[model samples]
Target: MKTREISKRKCIGCGEMKPKKELIRIVKNKEGEVSIDKVGKKPGRGAYVCNSLECLEKGMKSRRVERSFKMKIEQEIYDKLKEEIVNE
Candidate 1:
């Protein structure tokens, strides 16, 4: 029998390693657009965060997500992410 591998990702907010499916993916595509990747199948630079607003705020305050993407993120983007997290 073959064993399946569980993919793990680090959360930029809480800085914890967790299963990929349990985290929210934020992607920056070739066009330099950042958005939440609910399906986790986007081709771009990706950062992971927990599914909680607290983690989102922590990532925002620490600038971890911005550093991960190596660019300046706008307030609108953060707001969008927050809304998504809340809805989830």
Candidate 2:
């Protein structure tokens, strides 16, 4: 029998390794648009973060997302991502 390999990604905020599906993905598309990728299928470069607010806050405060994406992250994008995390 063959075992399936699970995908793993590091959280930009907490610096923890977790299953890809267990983390939220933020993507920057070819058009230079940044957005939360809930489905993880967006066509772009993706950064992962935990679903917790603490992690989200840390990521924002420390500019982890900005560093990962190599671009400035708008406050509204962070707010929207936080709302989604909190609601989940």
Candidate 3:
């Protein structure tokens, strides 16, 4: 039997490489809207982060998401992401 390989992505916050399924994806759509891609199927540029407040805060403090998406992110989007992370 053959085993499939798992995809990995770097966490923008902690700068660690982790399995894609284990990280949270933040996507920016073509319309320039940003949101959390819970299913990881959203079409757009995506940035990964760990599922923790520390990672989230680090990402925010460093503005990694903004850099990855090449645009300014609203505080509301970050707030929404934080809420989702906490709820999860």
Clashing pairs in 2: none
Estimate, for each residue in 1-88, the C-alpha lDDT of model 1 and write its tens digit.
Answer: 9999999999999999999999999999999999999999999999999999999999999999999999999999999989988988
Question: Can you write out model 3's per-residue Cα lDDT over 4-72, one digit (the tens) per residue?
Answer: 999999999999999999999999999999988999999999999999989989999999889999999
Could you tell me which 10 consecutive residues in candidate 1 have the lowest summed lDDT? Answer: 79-88
Q: What is the C-alpha lDDT of each candidate?
A: 0.95, 0.90, 0.94
C-alpha positional error of residue 61 in candidate 2 after TM-score superposition, expressed in Å: 1.6
Evaluate residue 22 in candidate 2 and report its C-alpha lDDT on the 0 to 100 scale.
99
Please identify which of the two predictions, 1 or 2, would achieve the higher TM-score against the true structure. Answer: 1
Which sections of candidate 1 miss by over 4 Å? none
Give Cα distance to truth, residue 86, candidate 2, Å.
1.3
What is the per-residue lDDT of model 2 for residues 1-88, given as tens digits with 9 covering 90 to 100? 9999999999988999999999999899988888788899889999999989999889888998899889988898888888888887
TM per candidate: 0.96, 0.93, 0.95
Considering lDDT, where higher is better, how would the candidates rank from best to worst?
Answer: 1, 3, 2
**TM-score, prediction 2:** 0.93
